[model samples]
Every structure is written in structure tokens, then in C-alpha cells.
Target: MVELVVQKYGGTSLQTTGRMAEAADRIIKETKRGSQVIVVVSAMGRTTDDLTTLAGQVSSCPPAREMDLLLSTGEQVSCALMAMALKAGGVEAEALTGPQAGIITDFSYGDAVIKEVDPEPVRSRLKEGKVVIVSGFQGCPGGHEVATLGRGGSDTTAAVLAGALKADRCEIFTDVDGVYTADPGTITGARKYEQLDYESLSALAELGASVVHPRAAAAAEAWQIPLVVRSSLTEQTGTTILPGTWSSCSFPVIGVTSETGLSSFSLHEGADRREIGREWKNGLCPWKAVQHVKNRLYRIVVRNEEAPHTKSLLSRFGGRPDTGRALVHVIFRSKEGKQKAGSFMRDLPYTQDCFMVETQPHVWSMDVPERHRVNICQALHDRCMEKEAAPISAAH
Candidate 1:
């Protein structure tokens, strides 16, 4: 038989008992396909949120250890429910928490990374020909320190399992059909990629695609593990993510995706502010998109002249006046910055369908989707290269 396949089902995929049953069937099917199966799952949909709210009810501000202990229950409940469902289906399955599963990590509550995973117990269960269902997001590694993968860490959990088991592929099942150009919820014509390499998908995920978590991609790529973003809704082919390219295609526009909760800022106090701008890099929005076919967008840094004026601008935009402990040191997503979005998008494919694409002047805004940016940008770049080639060719 082939090596075990590490499969991960997200919160949405395991929202209900019926959904869990469906997922269990899928896991069983994979197990019967000569693939030893180890499954990882997150808490059911909204369960974590509900738990947090419940804890907040008891204490307006709960301590981190208590928070970790409270938050960890959602995944445990899910793991147990899934195991029960699997057993009901006449499949012998065992559910294990991150602690019981031997997922050891540094002592950090609420947000922790996996330091190591001892798959001995998992291997033993598989040896007895039983399927193993492991909790995905929360792990208890050390004393009183329950570590939870920060948002979307379940994907990281699955990748870690795949690496530990030496699995050939890690299948992540979600609600969507597959990874698309833009979020299907926003753009109807968003194209679906048949496949992508780990690098490109990882870049996409880093930029803003929540389809896969960056930490998970990093782990999988480091281990040279293959991951596929499949669907729980159907048995059809999902997008395949390899370490390299898939077959060729002529789709000029690869895809479209957007980042909500996005805030833009401008820094303009000094000239050549690269050094100051560099410090703001951590809060930089990393996602990119292909708007359509003709242009590209890039992120740049904006700096300001005076700290006082910058602080005023930030305060005007609902930011606290305290600059020392702010997430955004510079004022981004200010009213002026928001107003300039239309003009900025005009030059990129991202604004291809803008109200006045041709009318607006191009301003060097930091927010540009990498793919399908303004088509006119490509036209300009192409024209510049052509002019350079023409002059050189004529001289030759």
C-alpha cells in the first residue's frame, strides 16, 4: 500500500454532523484506495467564536491560559464528534487532541507554532488498520500552555502532519470549487486555475488568498510535499498545487482575488524615506490579484514630512494618537488615500471595470494587484520596451 495521505478538512467542511459524515466518507474512501489516511480537522463553523464570546461573558477580559483552555474545547469537540461519526459508519477511527497526538511546541498561548510531532501513536493506530483523526488548529504541547495556530493555522497543521507521516500528498478540502482568480463571492467570472506550483500558490496565499495558509505552504514546500485544494461539495477535479508548473494555457487572465479589511496609508513627510518606509513593511498587505489582462499592480511605500501632521492624519482616520504602539506607524487608508483608490485602479486591470478608467490620471499608489492590473500599464510597459528595441535595432 502507498504511504498514508494526510488530509485536512476546514471548519466549514465540518460544520454539521451531516457534513462530518460526508467528510468521514471521503476519508474512508481515501483509506480504501490503498492510502493510509490521517485526517486533521478544525472546530465546527462558528464554534470558536461562540466559545470566545462565552468566555468573555464570564470575564470581560480572560487570561491567556484560560483563553487557551476555553478555545481548545471547540477542536476537541469536533474531533470527538468526527470520530463518533466514523465509528457509526462501521469504520474504526480514533480521535486525538494536539497534546495526545504528540504535537509539541514552544510555550505560547493562543498562538503557537509546531516544534515537533511524534507520529508514533498515529503510526500505531494505522498499524492496527484504524484511521486517525487529529485535531487541526489547537495543540497542547507543554504544561498549562495550550497553543493554537493563529488564524487559519489548520492548514499549517495539515502540512505538518503530511511532513511527519512522509505522505505523498496533503489534500485540503474546503467549501469552494477550487482556488479562483478572484473570490467567487465577489467576481462571477473569476477563472479557476487547473493547477499551481507551491511557490505561486504560496505567494498568492501570502498576498491575500485565504485558501491556504502561508505557514502551511512553507512547511509543505520545505518538505517537498504536494498539496491539493479540493472541494467537499463534489468529487470533481480540484486545483492541484505542485512544486512547479502544470500544463500550458492561453487564459490571458489567470484569476482575481480581493482583500477586505484593507486599509491604505500615505507617508509624505520626507524625500527618500526608504528607511522609515522599510519599518512599515510588516503591516503591508501582501495579497495580489490579476484584474483582467492588460495591467499589473504593485505595493509601494509612502512616507510623510512631519510626525505631528502624520499623527493628525492618523487620528482623523480612527487611529489612536499614540504613535509608539500603533500597528500602522504611518497613516494609510486615510480619507485622501481612499479617495485616490479610483485614480490608482484606473491604471491597473484591478480597475478595468472602474467608472472612469480612461479619465483618471495614474497616481503611484501602493495598492496594486499583481495580476490583471490596469491593462494600460502593460500597454505602457510594452510600448517603452518596443521603443527601446526600435532605437537599438535601428542603430545596429
Candidate 2:
């Protein structure tokens, strides 16, 4: 039986016409290898950002439904161009929108959840020996209305399609070759993993590693589908995420991840934490939820993109806001690793502004100055992570 693979190309991989052509050639090469291929693509380059800017210029507060309709076009444009490129490469291919490909989603306009996938449309195309290229981010909720699956939705799209189709594996092509112990761009001598378990990858993604989206990781894990993170521009084999945790004798703290562009709210004494938490019904979820209310203060961190709405919602409950903060997480694979990292965090030298807390047994989160986040991550990686991860590649 022939292998079936679902490949997802992110925005950077399809940013230019030349890049798109290269991607087409990549697909062509795979088809020649006797693998059935389905392609999922994101908006080319910064097309989504450009469109959002245009929408904001026209209306201060654009309607959610119309905004989604506008953003969905970006993926369509890229998918069609990819099909054209594949044809130019002498391969039979077809372009499809999310709905046309049979992705049914919920009614949420901006961040719709996929309800189910009717795989026949894509399956028939594959049977015809044609590569099926589906627009990644947009799906139809019902009728003719187009709904989008927010940021990193394309990743979610590919994962879901792979699961529904029971493809052999899902290949996510991005700018990076694989998952790293730290952001390769920021930290020197950052080690790259050849393989990881689904739980570790999901933890890293949720802690602000952009190599893969958290939801995509979750979906792939639930379906027990294997995933590979590779670079579209290189021939090197990337990291493969499979079942089971790392059972290595090396350092259990495998990676350190950080998220910036965040704001926090501190509710004062006598404040109803439960009431405020329950009443806050915004699009953004808390990055860090204060598990234990200590003394007079209870705090929550939210993404900066939703800060305005979040601030407005919390103002009613006397929530004081602090902007320009970053969250750094040291992720460990075992209890021993966590213990070592916790000790390092306590000994690390920092000013009074930095606050460290162990939110989970396997993770330690720090609220530090946004400007010093890189330095902090670098310091942690060099001292705690590098010595134990000798087998991994130090090359970016």
C-alpha cells in the first residue's frame, strides 16, 4: 500500500513566488516517491497582517463576520497559486477552499472550532492521482458564511485533516528545521532535538515555542498521529514527535520556552476572584492563572493582543493592570529535572522586578522584564540545559 502524508506549509515557507515554486517541487518529488500528498497552506508572507491593517483603516471596529470573510481570502490566494505551481511542475493538482474540501466548523466567526471533516472530497482527488491543496485557515460554519480558525489555525487544519484521513503522518514545514532547546535565533549553541514525545512538544508549544501550535499538537496526540517538524528550504531531517515521553538518563529539563507581549492584572484585597474570573468572557484565555490567592493579591496574565478588551472587562472588578511583561518557562521531563531547575531559579541573580513561581511540577514560570527575557533564557540554557544535552545538535 502507498503511504499517505499531509504536508502543511506555513506563511514563511510560501512567502514568495520562488518559495511557492520550490514548495511545489518538494510536493512533486514526494509524489514521484509513490506517496499520496495533501497540501495545506497559509497566507503568503504578511498578507494576513496587511489585510487586518486594511480592515482597521476602513473601520475602527470592523464586524467580526466581515473581518473573517476578508482574512479567509489570503489562504485561498496561496492555495490556488500552489496548484498553479504544481501544474507548471508537470503534476496534476487541484486547489480547494476549506469548505469545498468539506471542513465543517462551529459558528464562532473569528476563531471557529472544527466540528468534523467529510474526507470524500479530498479522498476522491487523491484517488484520481492528483495532489489536493486545501486552503488552511477558513471553513464554513453553515450556509455561505466563511469562518476562520484564528492564529496558527493552519496548523490545526493540517492536524485535523491528517487525523480524519488517517494519513501515515503530518509534516509541518516551517522556517526552523526542528524543535530546539531554546529559540535558536536568540540563544547561541541551542540544541535541536531529533525526536520528542507528544506531551513534551505540547508543553513547549503552550509555553510559547512557535515551532508548533498547541492545539495542533493536542489534536495530533489525541489521534495518535505522528508529526514531523521540518524546514521547507533544507533537505535535513527534522524533529519527529511520536508517542511516549523521553525515557533518557540525561537531564530531564529538555527545553526552556518564553512568551512576550503580555499584560497582567492584580485584583486587590476583598476582591471577588471567582466572580471576576467567571464574569470575564473575552476571546483571550489567561496565560498564567494564579492557582493560589496569596494575601491581598490575585493576578492573571493575558495576551497583549486582547489586552484592551481584557482591561476593559477587568476594570469593573478593580483589577489593576501592568503591561510590558514576559513569561519564561523551564520545562522538565522528570521530577529530578524540575528540582534542579527550581534550585537554579532560586540562585539566579536578578533584580526585584523578576518573580519566579512553580506553576506546575514539571514547569517553572517567571514574570520578568520583557527586555531581559532573552538574556535570562540564555543564562538558564547555558547553565542548566547544555551540559546534559550533549547528544543533540548545537547548530541552529
Candidate 3:
């Protein structure tokens, strides 16, 4: 069987002129191994922010639809640079926009979900022995309007490609060697995982592991696609999100990931509480849910980066933060211990009595306790179990 691989290069991996060339060279080297290649590239650096700034200047409150149009340029610039890099490496490569690549999505503007991918052109180019470079994270649905898949979206594009093309593996090239136990910059003794299950990977994504998108991981997990997170700066192997990598490892949380600029909502009002609790929601839209309370007092979590806007958003509706952090660990717990350990979750909407989200043996979870001066993590250390781990291989 012929081998075809789908690889995604994040913004940091394509930050500088040298990095762009370096990334292209990596893709070209893979192609030279007699395998077909499909490459996904993000905007070189803060191009998305630059575009956002321009969009805001044009419209005080930029519409989501138009913002998609502005942000699509990020991926285009990346694709062009990647194509140029491939050409410099003696590879016959062509960069195609999301539409040109046939990535069909729903009508969502800023965060569209991929619906279908016609891989005919992609496969044709590969059959003709050419490398195909695609602009990730943006696609069109039912018309000519450009749509974006939101931040950290390019990773989803690559995983979707792997599922559609049935590639050998979806290799994600980023700055880190692989998924680590923590940010490494923050926590001590943060180890990297050789392999992670899809469920665990999703947990990490929610916890701020930038290596993969939860939506993309969902797609790959649904199709059993092998997804690898490796460093573009080094030859070392990264973490692989696989099916049964943790049949033995009993770690309840595979990694300690954090997110900053978070705002937690604390609702307190009898009138508001009596109206079926129409407020508190968390995470992305799909992950959103309604919160029910006997009283109006409620809490919601939001990114600190958006706090200024969030405060304004809530001020309009009588919202206030009980307290928040510039950054948070966003911890994880296993289903096995959900009821025993996180009984507080029963009071919220997303959380139910013993009703937990999907999880793996190696998974991550988080929650906020009633008491602010609490650390739920002291028990996480007890989650580590003795298993037959292979001798730790030096990253290479």
C-alpha cells in the first residue's frame, strides 16, 4: 500500500523566515522517502493578530463573518511561504486554499466545523508525485464567504485530513518535543509522554495543551487516526495519541496544563435564579450547556484575556466574578474517582451526580472547589501508579 502522510505546522514552527524554510525542508525530506505528503501550515507568527487589528480598525465591533475573511489571510501567507520552501528544497509542491483543497464546513463564521473534504485533488496531486501544501483552519461551506476554525484550529485541519485521506499518521510539528506532564516552564518534574490515548489527549486540549485541538482529536479518535506531536526544531520523537497506549498505565492525569486570564462567574440573584438559570456556560460553544440553580447566584469561567470584554459583557447582565486567576492549572480527574472526589460538580449544569465526561485511563480533568483556598491536586500525586514503563528513551 502506498503511504501518504498529513503534517501540520503551527505558527511557532513557521515563525521566522528560517523556520519556514526549515519546515518546508522537513516536509520535502518526507516526500523524498517515496511517500506522498499533505502539509498544513498556520500563519507565520502573529499574522492573525495583525489581521484582527486591521479588522477592528475597519469595524469597531467586527462581525464574525467578516472576521473570518480577515483571518483567512494568515493561513494563505503560511501556505505560500511553505510552497516556496518546498520549491527551494527541490520538491514539486503547490499551495491550495481551503476552498481549493475542497474542505467543506458548516456555516459557522469564526469557528466553523469541517463537514466534508473532497480529497480528489489532493490525492490526484499525490498520484502525480507532487507534494500538496494546504492553508489550514479556514474553509468555505455553502458559498464564497471565507470561514475560520477559530484559534488553534489548524491542528484540526490536519487531523481531519488524516482521517479523510487515511494517512499513515498525522504529524504535528510544533515547538515542543511532545506533550509534557506540565508546561515545563512552570511546574517541576514535568515529564513527557511517549504515547497518549485519544480521550486523554482531549483532556489535555481542554487543559491548554496547544499541541492538538479537541475537535480535531475527536475526528481522529472517531476514525482511529494516529496523531503524533513532534518538535520542528529537533529530530526527537514527540508524543503519539494512539488507541490503547495506556492499557497499563494507571495515571489518572497524564499532564498538568494551564490557561491564563480566566474569569469565573459568580451569580447571585433570586430573580435570575428563578428564571431557569439562563447564564453560566463554559468552554467552546459545542461544549456549552445551561446551568440550573434554585437561586440566582451562579458562577461562570472565562479567559482572563477576555476579562475586560467579559466584564463588560456581564456588566450588561449583572455579572460579576467572585475571583479569578491570571492563569490556572485546569486539572483533571478520572471517572473512577469523579463521584468520590468531585461531588461538588453535582451542583453545576455540565456536571451531574456521577455523570462525568468521556475519559481514558490516562486522562486530565479540573474543577473549582467551594472554598477558594483549596488545592485539589495534592491527591493527584497519589494517582500515579507503578506500571511496566519501557526504559525512558532519550529524546532524539
lDDT of each residue in 1-396, candidate 2, tens digit only: 899999999999999999999999999999999999999999999999999999999999999999999999999999999999999889999999999999999999998999999999999999999999999998989998899999999999999999999999999999999999899999987888887888888989988899998889999998899999999999989998888755542457878889888877766677775666455434245446443356433676777886777677767667776889888889887787878887887777875777774355579888777988998898888877856654363221
- The lDDT of each candidate is 0.62, 0.86, 0.68
RMSD of each: 10.6, 3.1, 6.2
TM-score-sorted candidate list, best first = 2, 3, 1
TM-scores vs. true structure, each candidate: 0.72, 0.92, 0.78
Q: State the local distance difference test value for candidate 1.
A: 0.62
How far in Å is the alpha carbon of 96 misplaced in model 1?
0.5
Task: Tell me the tens digit of each residue's lDDT in model 1 across 175-233.
Answer: 88666554555443444666666655664575456888889989988888878887887
On lDDT, who's better, 2 or 3?
2
Which segments of candidate 3 are over 4 A away from where they belong? 245-248, 267-298, 303-319, 326-396
What's the ranking of the predictions by lDDT, best on top?
2, 3, 1
